[model samples]
Target: MLRIGRTPRQKPGGLKARTGIFGRLKKDRSGATALEFAILAMPFFVILFASVETFVAFTGEQVINAATDNIARQIRTGQITFNQGKSTDKTRTEFRAAVCQEIAVMISCSASEAETPSKLFIDVRTVSSYDNLPPTLPRTGGAGSDINTAGFDFAPGGPGTINMIRIYYRWTVITDLVRPYVTNLRPAGSSMPNDYLMVATSTFQTENY
Candidate 1:
């Protein structure tokens, strides 16, 4: 007669070893902090970079605004005249130089202010009324369109005339994570958005000087 004795119960050493190893792994907290920190680091750094970039963008906007007001004041008071036949006559290039002199600390400008291919775009003209001022941004079509500078001109009015100064600067975005939301400007036909268009406009009547 064969006695079925539970097959002599095989030793569970290997099973116990595996179970013990798994238990030890579960109890180990050596790498827990590191793992959690690794998981949180991505968002932490993203927020840091985004915050820094936003502050920088705000500073840039203020810089351009100040420059616009200063330049507009000069044009309004006859301190800066365009294409006038006089010893103090200033050209568009000179006007750009004047603007660059104020904003060069924040934005880049060529060594020669008269140089073309600048990131700064300026539109100064005489307007009959505020309603006649440009109602739209200097964009061609969509948000991804290239800046339309074809209609831009430098024709500041004389004394007692109404003049408008509109300045646009293509601010290079540093943080890639916050670029697209910062501005709607992007190069035409390019999938990647890059720049933050900074705009400043001043409309006022030139003082009778």
Candidate 2:
């Protein structure tokens, strides 16, 4: 009798072993790549934005400080008028111009260089003698209405005295990205309307005999 050819029997475990290897490979694939990217990107973006804002705020402060210091020096040296005869408005305009120029140089920002003329406000107060005792007195009032109402008096035969010069500037950020965060870094609105106030005071004793 011719016997039927018998096929070799396959091992039952072989198929299961192949399936297990493929399953593990699929599971090990780098998971949630998109989620990983999103998580990593947020902090970088926040840091970058914060750095930009901080730099802008710092630069603005430096520019304002330098401008105010220069104006104070001019007043102290008598280059700018503080007496009653000269037009206060005219002196104010000139002081503003000088400050703007100085700030432009300091910051090198086009916005700073081309600031709106209306944004600059200056007040000069002169007191020849405080309480009629000395030739001059220390100038005060950087944050109140007292400076606006007070007047400096010249001693008879005493030198001219300029009690104070206050410079106020309303600087608007050209880069709006960081404006809100830094707006409060400036002086309070009580001293300035739209922005911060930089007050530089210089007391001068008249050299005129």
Candidate 3:
């Protein structure tokens, strides 16, 4: 007796053969849901993080404004007096202390608080008259100052001298989306690195005391 070998033939649509119309219909559709979620999740997170960043920056600016306005009254009413001579270490410390009192409580006001004092820059100037007052916003001069240009003297002039206080906080943007949109004043090679700038200013004449 002669035995013949024969191969097993697959039917037109086998259970494992995913090639025909029936196979295509039976294919898994669960992955479609995951793909849809992945497509939408990215934009959702971007928008969410961007909004959080905006809120943080805006609130910080408002805090700085409030703190500056609150401190200006002290200078306006002559509570904080200026020495007739140059700006001494004691005067600088006292001014910083006053600023820190209101600002440090809310956010890191001084670089000293965070190991970098330039992070918060204060400029205070008292001139004999408003005619001597420099442009308020978009200051062309350098960072934190509490003095006048005349020999770089502390011009918190006594009795009825016009005074101006300017505060700047280099606020870093949280999200990358905001960094480009927000203001970035610091140059690329600067010691102090920041993305956005928060500025607060107040001007008043000192009371005769």
Candidate 4:
């Protein structure tokens, strides 16, 4: 029969039953968990990686501090002397070897890099008095700031002298996401910022040998 004024609508369970399908889709919760995880995963992973890198960086500092103390003790007790040109006198290269040996577990330096190490910079010098010690980290600034190694030398004075040993290392940071907050160094020629400078200094008076 043909409808006269208004056509009759189909029933809920009838052939044209789109209302039920739409309602069921609206009530579905299948993807809710995945959606929540996707929103939180990025921040969670970032925090996790930052924590790990911080711990590693701290451990590296401790290793450096211990090495500095050990090397300074040798200087204090006359076990290692410098600049006298004696048979047992230690040169700059020998001093670096001792330092690398102390920190080998955390940092490695091969035989070839002993003369000019890429990662480590060491300074051993005699100070006239306790008030005359050099700055722990000396920087030369103009265009780009860098560690000033110009006055750095291995001239620890002989017996009954005050000496200081300072060590600097350019630690390569791998996690770039937290690098800006972790360090202020912007290594020259690098496309991205990545270095965290670590410094350790020790001062003591040499024993009468």
Candidate 5:
């Protein structure tokens, strides 16, 4: 009779205690959505930036193609007429500058801007033959190479002739976050590895002019 009121029997496995703890956690869903949003934000931004970079790269390629085609037409239609009286070297230099300027405008590049000129590599070649042709590579001259000699042949006429005008442009994403995502964004077989190059080659017959 003097025994204290018998303590309530303890739950056999503490299931009630565990259930209470878990039930409280389940009820507190206030921060769950916030945690999920934080987890997803990074990848979403990455994907968005990647998409923008990809679009810029494609737009650049199309612009280069258009400029190349225009220049090639000029070369093929004899608009860039070869004159025996004028120095071919001088004429070719002017032609390259003109074409490069055209491409600059197409891709929103500034020809006068020293910081990004090298970013737009414009190589125009007038190859006499494509046989046993070495891969087109960037020249390392102090003044840089001419557009007409940058790539393969864009000859007016010759045996097994292929008149080609190649335009190579490099675009560097100001943002490094998206650079790795783009494909073949740089020049073909280019040694400069960090930048994306866009190349456009237009080949036609001189006879067609």
Candidate 6:
């Protein structure tokens, strides 16, 4: 018995099985692409939405500024030809209508509901004289960037007066998901975290009518 050679060894099946398992793992590509996509999906969508939001914001900005400039033209041309104070009430109503009328249709500038006044916060006032005009238009403060609708003064001035029209808008993000990538200009305690401020100003002297 002792003279028998080394015991017959079992076939290396276990080793071969491990090698096959590792081989299959390397060749299996089903989940590889999915795994990569899962890792990059968040950033990809964030960029996509952010880019779209930027374009929309720029468009809205142009709308507000252009609308204010256009409205200013009316006052400058004497279309708003009215005396101050006594005629202020009527002028305000008409001017407000005009602002909404020429508002950017794409933006939600109208708020018939009491809860939302108008998305457009406006102030039209005339300084005592052109010499008194400040380098920057006067504005009341609120939650930092927010303009309280109550503080809006609608005084388009009388003919031959210097008047300024100021507009403010709180453009909100369609989704909060992309907010981190964009700057949040709204002050602290803002009603919405996704809100950004937009302001436009137009100043011109009302011509003698």
Off-target runs (Cα >4 Å) in candidate 1 are 1-12
True lDDT of residue 161, candidate 6: 80
Report the alpha-carbon TM-score of model 1 versus the true structure.
0.86
Please give each candidate's TM-score: 0.86, 0.52, 0.69, 0.84, 0.65, 0.78
**Global lDDT scores for all candidate models:** 0.83, 0.51, 0.68, 0.83, 0.60, 0.71
TM-score between model 4 and native: 0.84
Per-residue C-alpha lDDT of model 1 across residues 1-209, encoded as one tens digit per residue: 97776657766899989999999999999999999999999999888887888788889989999999999998888888876665656878888888888897887687764557468889999988888888887778886676899988889887788899999887888888877777568665657777777889999998888
Candidate 4, residue 40: how far the Cα is off, in Å: 1.3
Which number leads on TM-score?
A: 1
lDDT of 5 at 29: 93
Q: Rank the candidate models, highest TM-score first.
A: 1, 4, 6, 3, 5, 2
Give lDDT tens digits, candidate 3, residues 1-209: 98888978866665546566566767868689998989999888878887887788889899999999987787777667677543432376567767777876568654464333556667777767778776644533454322222332233556687888887777777676545555455454434434677788888987776
Kindly state the number of residue pairs that clash in model 5.
Answer: 12
Query: Considering lDDT, where higher is better, how would the candidates rank from best to worst?
Result: 1, 4, 6, 3, 5, 2
* Consecutive 10-residue window with the lowest summed lDDT within model 5: 141-150
lDDT of 5 by residue, 70-183 (tens): 876766655654542433322444665666667675565555532334555543444556663436544543223323333432234422345655566666765566665564
Q: Is candidate 3 or candidate 4 better by TM-score?
A: 4
Query: What is the model-wide C-alpha lDDT for candidate 6?
Result: 0.71
lDDT of 6 by residue, 1-209 (tens): 56967888876999989999999999999999899999999999888998998888888888888888888897788666455444333455566666777764766545552233456677777888767665653334543444556656677776778887788777877868866455445556534466666789887887876
| lDDT of prediction 1 | 0.83
